[model samples]
Target: MKHTKVKDLLNSTKPVDDVLVKGWVRTFRNNQFIALNDGSIIHNIQCVVDFENTPADTLKRITTGAAVAIKGDLVESKGAGQKYEVQVKNLEILGDSDAEKFPMQPKKHSLEFLRENAHLRVRTNVFGAVMRVRSVLSFAIHQYFQEKGFVYVNTPIITGSDAEGAGEMFQVTSFPLNNAPLNEEGNIDYKQDFFGKETNLTVSGQLEAETFAMALGQVYTFGPTFRAENSNTSRHLAEFWMVEPEVAFNDLDANMDLAEDFIQYVIKYTLDKCEDDLKFLDQRLTDEEKQKPQAERSEMSLLNKLQFVLENNFKRVSYTEAIDILKNSKPNKNKKFNYIIEEWGADLQSEHERYLVEKHFKSPVILFDYPANIKAFYMRLNDDNKTVRAMDILFPGIGEIVGGSQREERLDVLQQKITELGIDEKELWWYLDTRRFGTAVHSGFGLGFERLVLFVTGMTNIRDVIPFPRTPQNAEF
Candidate 1:
């Protein structure tokens, strides 16, 4: 008989006889009821067995985590929890799970413990829902970009130049470390290496995406990115995915509009498609928060927060204006901030960002026109010659979800900035060609995909939202 997925079975309009179902057993209660899940949805379908007529050996095999196929009659459930259930007439244990050996039993486990057993953690309700939401969010991103006639470009994973200029990058090489060939200056020789030059995993696809955008008009790149920062904080990851969209002939205002619309569309899409998962996560967050102090709890529920963002416009503020607010704010006045706001060129910390979004504005905020020295070299310089046309979208909980800018199009100014920053002119000659030949105002932004998932799912730690988190001192499967 053909097997029916649990999701379809649960949503069936009418009862049917002799339906076949296959899934892993979640729990077996009273030797009669079997809870099964197949990853189609977070909810499990109840399978009731006829214990009186079934053999003891076959019944014992229906343990948690065991795979089974049951031939049964679908009827209205008598239980108050679910709408329908399967009355099993025949049961076969395709795979057995020893009750004593299985790590995930029918009980609550700590998230830390689950992180250790990352391979099997998805079988749980929380991880299952989080992953489903993550998948839907990813699809929504592509759908939004495609609907707007944007071309999707695949950027290279390995590159010879650093995009962010942070110098925290993982080097890609095929040379043996112990006996590496040395050059005349006693440096590692790259002539015999795979790429014949030093290369590393790309930190961002914005640089490559720009080249395509110049030709294609508008393009977006969604792929994995890497960094070698040793911060072991909950929000930091050694490797993660980023979504970058580059558009030709766009300025700072148009770039802000694009980012705001893109984010709201994706959030709305997830809310519409992943209703069940979102509801489960909402309750999970509420229950988890009950254990903490009232001051530590979130101001709004998960659904309410998402709706608020869609309904309200993100507050736009200038970097100089934000500096004045922080300098006069109560936190800075009371000496509560770790880094006090004393001057104009000081970088804003997470505490300051949260104060703006969660306390002062009570909505998402976009801060633009950052200091030129602090921002990337490619951002367009302002008339003041001190600030650049950079913008960062700050969410309520997540500090900075999107970072973007209007790129410099003047060849002379760009080349001067590149020289001042000490970036190799020869290495970036191809990039410079775009400005030299046909210069046009262009803009784009890069979003941390996992951070979006973390906000939507109401997960506090960024690590929990992504599967197989790569952090410092930890790279387990």
Candidate 2:
């Protein structure tokens, strides 16, 4: 007989008389009862069997974590303490799982322990749930952009220039890491490397994606990106995924609309599909918070806040206003802040960002028109000359979930800014050529995919949600 999924069986009203089921054993009891889960649902169903009636060796062979096929009769089992139960008539061992050596067991394990066994960690309930949610989120991203007529652009993983303008980038080459290359100035010579000049793992695909958007009118790139920053924090990963969407003839407002809608769409999709997973995370969050001081509780109930943000409109504010709020804020009872957000000059820190969103705004807020000095050179210079048409979406717990801006489309302005910023114009020749051909106003943003996943899944550490996370000192799989 063909096997029926546990989920389908749960949903069906018809009596599950004489059914066939096959799955790995989650837990086994008294050599007769076993809990089976094939990841069809978050919760595993308990299967009851009569050990006296079955073959002794067959019962002995059926161990925990082993795959088994059961020819069973499913009855309305109320006394077995399960909503529905399967009583086995005959059992066949498909494969044996080494119960004593398998990394995952019924016992609760720490995240650190799970990280050590990253390859097999997906067997755990938390990881299994997260991977499913991650899968759905990827699909939701494609569906949202595709439905809006946005062309999906596959950007190169290896690039000549760093898109983030950050100096951290991993060198890629066929030669040894230390002895491969050298220049006359006693510097690591890229001339001997694969690209002949220099190339590194792409920090972001925004620039390349912009080229496609200019030609296609609207486009997006979703792929893995690498950064070699030595900082090893819970939030930073050496290798992570990024989503960048560019649109031609779109301004800051249009870009913000896309960001908000994209976020809401993903949140709604997860809630609709992974209700059980979200509930599990919610329980986990509650327990974690309970151990902390009562006053230090998270402001928004993670799950409730997600639903609220998905349904409500996001607030929009200018960088200047955010500064004013920060300045007016009562002097810190603790040490003075390193960078005081004075009227119009400094970059906003994570603490300042959280204050604005959690205290003043009480919701997700888009802080726009940041000071030109702090923003990227490609941002459009406003009439004031001090600020640029840039925006950063700041959420309560996580700061700067999205960063975007209206590109400096004017050739003269872009060229002058590039020169003034001491950037190599030759490196951006192809980009400048886009301006020479047909320059239309354009805007886009880079969403840190891991950060977004952290927000939606209520997972504290970014490493927890990602499979085989790569950090500074740890790349073990």
Candidate 3:
């Protein structure tokens, strides 16, 4: 018999005579009702069995986390929770899971406990919903860019240069740990390495994406990026995916427009396509918040928060204005902020960003014109020479969901900035070549895919949204 997915079976209008369903058993309750899920959707289909006629050995094997195939008749469910169910006539245990051995039982598990068991955590409702939403959000990103005639570029994962100029990078080498080749000066000889130079996993695809954008007109790269930052916070990940779009002839204004539109479109796509998963996550968040104090609770539900983002325009504020607002704010004046905003050139911390987005603006904020010294070298320098045409899109929960800026197209200015930052000029000759030949005003931004997923799924920790999170001192699967 052909297998029918639980999603299709549940949405079926007419009853089927015979159906074969194969999935992992979520629960076998009362030795009669079996909850089965095949990762097709968030909800599981109930399979009612005739326990009296069934063998005792077969019933014993129908435990949580057990994989099974059941041949049954499809019929409308009379149960309170679901719409349809399978009346099991035959059952085969494809894989048996001992109830005492399986870590995920038919009960709620803490997010931290689930993180430890990352490989099997998706079987649970929360992880399943989050993963599904993450998949849909990825598709939406491709869809939005493709529809706009933007070419999708797959940038190299291993590179010989640091795109972000951040010194923290995971070195990719083939040398033996204890027997590495050394030069006459006792320095590690990278020339003897595989790439004939020092190489590391790419931190961002924006620099490479810009090369394609100049020729292809507009290009976007969605791929894995690695960072060696040792920060073990809820927001930082050693390995994460980045969605970067580089557009030609785009200034700061056009870049902001693209960022705003892209964010809202992808979020709306998830809200429309992953209705069931979003609903489950929404309820999950609401239940979790009940344990916290009234003051710490969220002002809006998950669904309501998503809708609010779509319905309202993000508040656009300049860095100078934001600094002014923060300096005069009660937190800074009362010495409540850990990093007080006392000067104009001071970088805004997460606490300051949250206050602007959550407390002051009460909306998603797009902060632009950041101080030049605080931003990357590639950001366009303003005429005043004090700030850059950089922007960061800050969400209510996530501090900075998207960071991008207009590129410094002028060859001399870019080279000077590179020199000023002490970046190796010889290492980035290829990137500099883009400016040497017909450089036009181009802009791009890097959106941390996990952070976006964290925001959309209402997951608090950055680790929860990503599968097999790699953090400092914790790479266990």
Candidate 4:
């Protein structure tokens, strides 16, 4: 059956003779007013039912979560909440829902409870707004990259090499776990596997995308990546999406510019396109902030925090400079930091990064020239040889949103790094060839998609931003 979306119908300029809208029932108020939604938007369209004329059996089926088709006349809404609604002329129950058993009732549900019912949580206003904002943000990402003339490339999911060298990778195997083939050393013989070699789920697409950048000049990979870390923190997930863009002939300065501009553009795009959903989330956040202590509450509202990013220029500082600032910061000096910055080359924790962005700089900061020892082996080594041309864009609430560097284009320096890190050189033979052939100065960054969504939606937990979060011992739908 042909039906108009509730979103379009709600924004109608004038009345319509007959309109059909099929959606799930949100609520049946007094058996006279029906709140129906088809997932076109967060708000439900009100359908006023003529309960006096409708059959008792048909009216009883109009329960929450039930699927129904409403044929009605569209006109101005006398209701306070919505602008326009439907005057139901006919109502047909397409699918019946048991009122006693429907998990998503008309009452408010806690985030934890909603997580358990993840499949049905989208029926709620908050999740509906979040997922809708997520969809628009995804589209904005692609639109921004496409406008910049970047080639969208799909990288392999299974790989024989670890891009980050973190050693937290999920192994892929077809052999029996108990009786896998073994060599003389009694280790599992990878050659007997289905792929004829050991492989694991890819951690990052940066390594593969770099090869394409050499040929295409600018390329990006936006796809799922996996990690095997056992942490169950609100900030981590076993499986998540990554957006890695590699550009040839782009140095550290160009890379930083791209990251800032790209973030601002996509955020503005989402703000413009998903105004209704974002406004809903903004209010949701404001209410949530009310529950917190006065000292802990955010100074700016959600929308203001977003506008802050768009209006201000991200402050650029070297890693050494950040370390110096943190050394004298009140948190570090007063022993309030969990991981104190004692000296240079010290690894900065989330608290430290946040202090630099939220407190010290008082704006988004792009920290560059990080110590080479703390970064991956692929980043280029500076002439002083102590640090690399690396940078991380730090947001106010989010610590490190984007991590990237000017890749080491010199074959010898890269080889030395690979050897120093004890990584098997043969596994990255193809990646190495990118430098051997036509490599010039190149740079790129990897942004966690969930982190971006979390920042945009004002969601505290990383799990809440993604539809189905894969975490330690919890993979339930």
Candidate 5:
């Protein structure tokens, strides 16, 4: 028999048609109504099952969260709230779930408890919405780059260089830890390791992607990256996905434009394609009505601002300008800040980032040309010799979703920066060779896919945005 998705059944104009729908039961209301969803839509179709009319044998087989196939005739019902209903003719139990043991219930569950049940959280409405938005946002990323003549390049997960140059790396080896290569001092020798030298999971794919961009003109890498930083923040994870797009012959301004356009594309796509999911998230997770305190109004206001951002252009500002605005604010404001937003050279924390984009700017902000000392080594130095051509796109709530810069094309300057930054020049011969062979001006940015998903889905935690998130102290399936 042909199967009809539950969502299609609900959205159809003809309700009185024969339909077959299968899904795990969300809840059975009053033993008469069954709300079933196949993870196909934000809303579930309510299958009105009259237990009195349903065969006694079939009724006995049904349970909450159980996989069931129902052959039914859809009917238009003028119920109190529903637009359509299903009249069941036959019920087949595909699988039975013990209601008592299942993690989800009709009542609300805390996000923390749901985190512990990563495998089962998708069955919940909030998580299902997150996964759906995550999917559309990812598709939009590929769509934006492909339309702009950018070739999709897959970079290696294992690497010899740290693109972020942050020094957080995870080692890879075929040998067991107990019997690995030893040095003269009897320590585990990285020189004689499996890859014949020190190697670790790549922190970012920017450097390798830059090589491809120089050849292909424009290339983007979308893949997994690892960091062994042991950070346990709600935003940091051990393993996550990133999209790094590098373009040749681009400067800091071009880099900022690309970042802004790419973000606008994703936001517009998610708003257009995942309307139902976004509405669901906006209602349940980010609604002002759901906040517990009046002080939390700004948090909800940020959501409205994000929605408005889709229809508006982002604001561009230099680091110096942002600092001046912060310095000018009154010493005592109505809303005290969690972290101070200071002068140009200081790193912008999340609190400062949120305030700039969400409250002060009231729109998305692109802060460019960060101080060279605080940024990575590959960034091109401005003529002033103080600032680097680095750019960060700060979104409300998420803060710095994209970090990028124009690469130093001059071999001498790059080599000098490498040495000054304490990075080994010999280890990056292939990277430097891009300059030797015929280097062109290039720029790229790495957008943390999880953070993008959180921004798109209105999810408050990075853990909820990623499936089976690999955070510190948690690797369970």
Candidate 6:
């Protein structure tokens, strides 16, 4: 007999005979009732067992975390919470879990505790809902691009150019660290490295995606990106995924529009598709916040927060305007901010971003025309020569969810920027070719996928959204 998914049976309109269900036992109650879950849905299907007829030895094996199959009659649940229940006629234990040793038992767990037990975290309700929503969001991302006829481009994972120009990329080398071959300059000879040149896990796929955008007209890269930054903040993840979409003949405004629309579409799609999971997360967040001080808690629930993004247009403001607003804001005036905004050229921090979104604008915000010195080299230079055609999308809780810019198409200006930054010209010859050969106006943006998931799932920490998080010193399953 085909094994019936718990999700499908829970939605059944009528009774079914001898339905087979296989799942890990969530809990065994009264030696007669079992809560079984297969991760197909957030809720578990109760399986009523025949304790009188069943052997006591077999009954002892139906412990939490144990894998079991039940052949039962699906009937209307007598319990108040669920709609359906299974009257088990046959039971078989496929695998027995040591109840004493299983890390993920039915209980409230700290996020840090679950992080330590990531391999088994999904067995918990919180991780299950988060991961389910994550899967739906990922599908929505690809679906959003594919439906729009955008070419899906797979950029090289090992790349030579630092797209962000942040110098925080993790170096990739096959040579043993201590025994690397050296040249006369007393530096490791990268020419002898695996790629015949120094390479690192890509920080961004924007540069490579731009090359494809020139030919394919529109292209996007959804892949893993790495940053070697050692920041231990909840929002920072050394290894995360990025969604980079590049479009030819697109100016900065068009880039901003594409980003806003793409994000809203995927987010809306996820919200619609993962209703149950999102609801679970919303309740989970509400429950978690009850322990926090009122001032520190989120003003809106997760569902409302997501709906707010979908309902409102992102307020577009320039960097100078944002600086002015932040400078006069209560935090800056009262010296409440950790990093006060004193001038125009300083980069905005998360606190400032949240202030703009949740306090000032009370909506999603987009601040454009950032200082050239602070942005990457690829951004198009403005007439003022001090700012670039760059923009960032800031959300209420998650600051700077998206970063993008109108790419510099002029070879001379780009080379000048590269030279001024002391970047190796020889290394970026291929990227320069796009400008050299028919580089029309082009623009693109990169959305941190994990950050998006964090926002959509109402997860405060970026690590909680991704399955296996790789931090500065911690890389475990």
TM-scores of the candidates in the order shown: 0.99, 0.94, 0.98, 0.99, 0.95, 0.99
> Which is the winner by lDDT between candidate 1 and candidate 5?
1
Per-residue alpha-carbon lDDT of candidate 1 for residues 56-142, written as tens digits (9 for 90 to 100): 999888899999999999999999899999999999999999999899988999999999999999999999999999999999999
TM-score of 3: 0.98
Q: Which parts of model 3 are misplaced by more than 4 Å?
A: none
Q: Write the per-residue lDDT of candidate 2 for residues 79-100, one digit (tens) a residue.
A: 6445677888878889988879
Candidate no. 4 TM-score: 0.99
**Clash count, candidate 3:** 0
Q: What residue runs in model 1 are displaced by over 4 Å at the alpha carbon?
A: none
Candidate 6 structure quality by residue, lDDT tens digits, 1-477? 899999999989899998999999999999999999999999999999999999999999999999999998999989899889999999999999999999998988889999999999999988999999899989999998999999999999999888878899999999998899998999999989888988899998888999899999999999999999989999899999999999999999998899989989988998888888999899988998998998899899999999999999999999999999999999999999999999989989999999999999999999999999998999999999999999999998888999999999999999999999999999899999998999799999998999999999998888899999999889986
Error of 4 at 244 (Å): 0.7
User: Worst lDDT window (10 residues) for model 6?
Assistant: 157-166
Give, for candidate 4, the lowest lDDT window spanning 10 residues.
353-362
| Segments in model 5 whose C-alpha atoms lie over 4 Å from true places | 286-289, 299-303, 331-344
What's the C-alpha lDDT at position 252 in model 4?
99
RMSD of 1: 1.0
Name the lDDT of candidate 4. Answer: 0.93
lDDT score, residue 158, model 6?
Answer: 93
Off by over 4 Å in 6: none
Candidate 1 local lDDT, residue 46: 96
Clashing pairs in 6: none
